[model samples]
Target: MTVLASSAPVLEVSALTRAFGGLVAVNVIDLAVHSGEIVGLLGPNGSGKTTALNLISGVLRPDSGTIRFAGQAINGMPAHRIARLGLARTFQLVRVLKGMSCAENVKAGLVFHRPPLSRGEIDESVDRLLRHVGLSDRGGLPAAGLTYIDCKRLELARALALKPRLLLLDEWLAGLNPSELLIGIELIRSLKEEGLSILLVEHVMDAIRSLCDRCVVMNSGRRIAEGRPDEVLADPAVIEAYLGVSPGVSTDA
Candidate 1:
């Protein structure tokens, strides 16, 4: 796998801003993901993590500022268009085609890729992806029948089918048990090893510390701190915003 230096960012957001009515969801946030880095996005609930992912993936348009991927300005582009440019994301709330089989749902994802594959190729790719996500035996099952963790894996397989250069994962570890979390972490690590740039929004600190080379902390729609995961997590601002206590202040009675 090719290692990405910090200077070569594959996804760049500069002064990005988004708002709904009077509520500013993302306020002039600037972020970047280098070609092979897994950057963690950390914040308390409603700190604009999902909103930022939406903007980056084109699920929502920014009210101001620029979003560029692979050197192309993608601001205002439709979600499909952005996805076709090799950017893909998984939702916080898993979304699968309830009526479709697992293989069919994965097939739907391959439709957006350039130079469409033949039927046989698509089928083969679907099988391979299902195996990669540990759903090889369940390919014929209806996605709706799968458990919550299986749904997350299905979504991940679907995202991988897009053959993305950059992936935004929103709370993918939220509902997983310890063993499931280990599998998820290993899968993500393997993807990163294959040179995929990932932006992870997760509440699991252990996962963040294990998977991320760096982290950005957000609060009230603004970035509060950004640095190495350990450093950022230890920042007084981050502690206060996330834990509601000033760093170094004892809570002991």
Candidate 2:
């Protein structure tokens, strides 16, 4: 069920700001992800895109402003608490338990967010999630044994095991080959079709253009543009901020 679809956004940030000593990493940014939508958080390196995701996921607390999730103010909540609250995420650099089997990794997610499950139910969930991320055959292998792309898939499965209402993906598609990228895009699309809300910080323009219903662009810790992926990516200001090209105008020269 797509709960809390119209009454409020699945995720909302208003005037969100965060700073580290002398530098401001996130500066009064505002954005929202509605239910059943995938919103691309796009920016170049060091554009505070990841930092913004960190704040939303409770890895870092905002210095000011507010974060609301499912109509509740979630400012300053701890990361684990946030995850248990039906928001889950994967990191830019995939985090996995190298010592654990892929199935164990997924089981960790289930038990973390859902501890009352019977052993049979946990096993069923782990198998299903691994299959969902195309790792059904590899579930018995060590997480360290998987290739980089496969590890990414494993991380996604673990996050899905949380059954999050809103999922934050921080550059989860950064290291895939062309074929793998296509598969990754389709996986994410299938999740959205299943009624998941996502905020994706992705560098792959093809994925962004294909998957995102809306895009929010950031430059130097502030939002520079927001709109349809194609339109926002084409905006002169966004182009300038992302590509360092001057917004040129032709005149009698």
Candidate 3:
């Protein structure tokens, strides 16, 4: 796969902050994902990783900040509008249309495309996407009947149906078994190889190590560090934030 050499970022967030009542969920976070880059967003629970994704994806409006995608300011834009611009995301929890067949669920995501696909084209695209996500034979099955891993796969197919330039993956690797985790990692790498920029929010340390070109560490709704994965993971602030102890201190002390 050929990587684009464009200097402009595919997604950019500056001083992004969001608050719910008196609680600040995300605070002054600046992030960027350039074309063909897979960046990991890592932090402990309640550290605002998912919240940051929501703000960037238009699920929640930022209280203060600017979000630019493909050179257009997208802050406060409706979710569907942002999606039409090639920014798509998967939820931390697998969400599928329980009543719809797997293929139908994927077809629903295509509703927003500009040129409007014909019936035959839509069917062909749906089949190809289901096959891509390893759900080729399950297209006729109701989505509710899929196992947890299959449900995740279905969500991925649906996201791909949008033909996004940038994909935000929130905890897509959370509940997979060892083998399933390996498959998930390979799938992400393949997407990256195809020139899809990704912002990944994941708890699996091994997957993060294998998939991320750069890592951003967050804690208490703030960005603590951003650098190469090995460097960020070894930073004193990241270690203390994740382990709740100083780097040199013994936990048993």
Candidate 4:
């Protein structure tokens, strides 16, 4: 878990910016995620966290900036191209293929990896990913039949099927009840323990505090703070801008 500052980051962004017509959604922001680390992207709604993820995952091209993943440049690349090159992501809203069974959704992701799995291999891998995401019993169900939280799990299972080098998770823990939230946190933590690099955008402070190795804060399309989770959460500006609390108040209280 000791990140070598001198080592190249698994994901690196420099002066990343994006705009929509008259509005600047992301300012010149710089970020990096090293191997085996989870970096939390924190901000209020509309603060450009999702915009940044879109840009990073190639869902939307940045107006300006550079994105390097696994030592390759990726700004302006198509989302499928990015996924093929070892990057995968989940959306802020879960995106399972509604017409497909849970296993089929994962199978769709499985076919993309090199050395394509045989039919049996694909089936076995799909089952493993389903079990990993706590959906082993539901693999035969249609995605449209899934509950909200189950949809989130199915989406995660599909993303994992890509075997990505870095995963961009946009609010993956949102909308869970307390017990489900704890399981969600632990699921992400287990992913980190497996040495997967992650950039997580989350509003759930508990998940961010428990799962992130470092945190990045943004406001009005610009990065405002970056540091350990506790350090950034304790920052006066971040508390006011994101947590909606006056300084000196504990968010956990």
Using lDDT as the measure, the top candidate is 1
Model 3 stretches with alpha carbons more than 4 Å out: 2-6
lDDT by residue (1-253, candidate 2, tens digit) is 3323344589989999999998898999999999889999988899899999999999999999999999889989998888888899999988999999999999888966655688899988888999999987888899989999999999999999999889999999898899999999999988898889999999899999999989999999999999999999889988788767766754345
Would you list the C-alpha lDDT of every candidate in the order shown? Answer: 0.93, 0.90, 0.91, 0.91
Clashing residue pairs in all predictions, respectively, total 0, 0, 0, 0
Judge candidate 1 at residue 72 and give its lDDT.
99
Off by over 4 Å in 1: 1-6, 250-253
TM-score of 1: 0.96
* Ranking of predictions according to lDDT: 1, 3, 4, 2
Best candidate, TM-score: 3
Extract clashing residue pairs from model 1.
Answer: none
**Residue 165: error of model 1 in Å?**
0.2
Angstrom error at residue 1, model 2 = 13
How well does each candidate superpose onto the true structure, as a TM-score?
0.96, 0.94, 0.97, 0.94
**Error in Å for residue 49 of model 4:** 0.2
RMSD of each: 1.4, 2.7, 1.2, 3.1
Can you write out model 1's per-residue Cα lDDT over 4-41, one digit (the tens) per residue? 54568899899999999999999999999998899999
Q: Which ranking of candidates, highest TM-score first?
A: 3, 1, 2, 4
